[model samples]
Target: MRIMAKTDVFIKARIIKGYSQRELAKKSGLSHAYISLLERSVKSVGPATAKKLSDLLGKELEDLFRIELL
Candidate 1:
């Protein structure tokens, strides 16, 4: 998946779950700056950090990535 798409999904999911970037950062044990960068797609996060976000959002890591329907 493209980094931007992945970031978008992550942010969308967080919003759907009623979390602000600051709240998500707290829950995910990440910095607010890092969370902002991730949500804005300004930085490409490594797998571990991505997994932490996924876990905090109660979503699977695979769901954050864009998947081909075929």
Candidate 2:
């Protein structure tokens, strides 16, 4: 699995939406820590988790997976 760099745009968007990590975790059916790890680029999300998160974030899976700094 590849670890992608964290994107400010993504994090900002989520924050601006007033989404708490626990809320996002509930909405995406992912663990809060797992989501945190992914956002920090400490871990990579698999297909299923990516799809769930993308859907929750209203973003495409490809967009979510993109590491703009790479």
Give per-residue CA lDDT, model 2, range 1-70, as digits (tens).
Answer: 5535246655765687679888888887778887788788778766677777767777766766763444
Q: Give candidate 2's TM-score.
A: 0.74
State in Å the error of residue 26, model 2.
Answer: 1.3
**Tens-digit lDDT string for candidate 1 (1-70):** 3333277678789999999989988887889998887777676666677677777788888887544342
Candidate 1 stretches with Cα past 4 Å from truth are: 1-5, 66-70
The weakest ten consecutive residues by lDDT in model 1 span: 1-10
TM-score of each: 0.74, 0.74
Q: After superposition, how far is residue 2 of candidate 1 from its true place, in Å?
A: 9.5
Error of 2 at 34 (Å): 0.8
Residue 47 lDDT in candidate 2: 66
Off by over 4 Å in 2: 1-6, 67-70
